[model samples]
Target: MAELQTHYPDVVPDLPDLYEPLVLFYERGGEFVRDNAGFLDLTGVLFRPGTLRGHLGAPSLSTLSDTVLDAVDAEGRISYYTTADGQGPLLRRRELRDEQRDELFSRDLQWEPTDRIPGSKEEAKDAGLVELDEIAAANLIAVILSNTSR
Candidate 1:
């Protein structure tokens, strides 16, 4: 975990709770960036069309974005995506393996409502958690703290 703090040093985002993961959803470029604890995990990033295959190396684990977007529950059960875009969309799930201790994959997630009022998809992504606006606010606070640490 020290490696994560040492590497980003000044860019670590604050999370809702110390135990909860902080996820970043990119609007224009359909992608998700996730930070768990002190380690950076990219198992859940998504891509649009077939362009995902071209961008698998740097950001996420796989480059194949040609997957149909589907939603599954945290228990690994097939469930409907409540989100507009997520509805009936076919999605591919990939597990990111860690070489060290047991680590959590970014793919392993369940959608909980964020306090952010939804307008556009981008707005929703930037809004942070569905039920926890405070978490989003904490991330903003983390950004400020990270800057000071630098």
Candidate 2:
């Protein structure tokens, strides 16, 4: 656990005190753009079972399902590992994040909790809000189209 504290400082914030597993969902090799499905994957980021309590910080595939090809949800959230009988969401809420507006997937593709839910602009500031801009949407379409051509 101390090794994690020494490494991947960026992931330290995610190492909660809880004994349960911690998943750091990624955008699944996709770009950061409005309405992108990969951005919503949650299970793709699981580090490994019991890693949460050990505080072995940073995200890893070990924490998630055994397979990488598993299906991800429309929001980019990974489906629960029913095959592995992994943990499922304790609760569900609809919300957005800042990554939804970025041009690239980089670090911005990561998800974070926000106080506000989707469809409410007023709560954006407090929550890691995602504002849907036409430019962002168009950018996504362009990327998808360009990639398909290749």
Candidate 3:
């Protein structure tokens, strides 16, 4: 807390209570950020598309602007596809392989609500968890905090 306050005097005080501990835990590099229950809950709460959109003043696509899409494509780290109806671009993964050479192909992929638990698709749906990319969530929080501090 002292380190955060000393390093980010102007910004630290403005951060909500829910955000501070997680930020500190992450800064300490104790372990995987996902291992922190508070961080996971914060991610589930604030990183959802609806919640982010609200924080971003209700933009049509929140932080997912065309410029961001183009930049992501230019980087070539991932591939994104546009919907035929022009809804938005989506990250499409064809396959992923584990250390054992077992493959999870596109057809075999099942969208689970949360990675914290093992459950059936129906159970996942009932869990009501919002799947969010950790890096993306961190970026979103930074953006929001930056904007709010000003």
Query: Best by TM-score, which number?
Result: 3
User: Against the true structure, whose lDDT is highest?
Assistant: 3
lDDT of 3 by residue, 1-150 (tens): 667877999878754455654465456442332433334333122333236547656322233333332222221122122233422222222222331111111222222222232243344235442322434433343343344457
Provide the lowest-lDDT 10-residue window in model 1: 61-70
lDDT of 1 at 120: 43
The lDDT of each candidate is 0.29, 0.32, 0.34
Candidate with better lDDT, 2 vs 3:
3
Looking at model 3, residue 121 earns an lDDT score of 30
For model 2 the local lDDT of residue 150 reads 75
- Over 45-91, each residue of candidate 1 has an lDDT whose tens digit, in order, gives 22243354675543421211212111221222111212333221122
Rank by lDDT, highest first. Answer: 3, 2, 1
Q: After superposition, how far is residue 55 of candidate 2 from its true place, in Å?
A: 53
What residue runs in model 1 are displaced by over 4 Å at the alpha carbon?
1-56, 62-111, 122-150
Among all windows of 10 consecutive residues in model 2, the one with the lowest summed lDDT is 81-90
Model 2 clash number: 14
lDDT of 2 by residue, 1-150 (tens): 546866877777555434332323233433333234334333333222343467445333232322212212234321111111212111113223433321122123322443224333444324443443222323333343344457
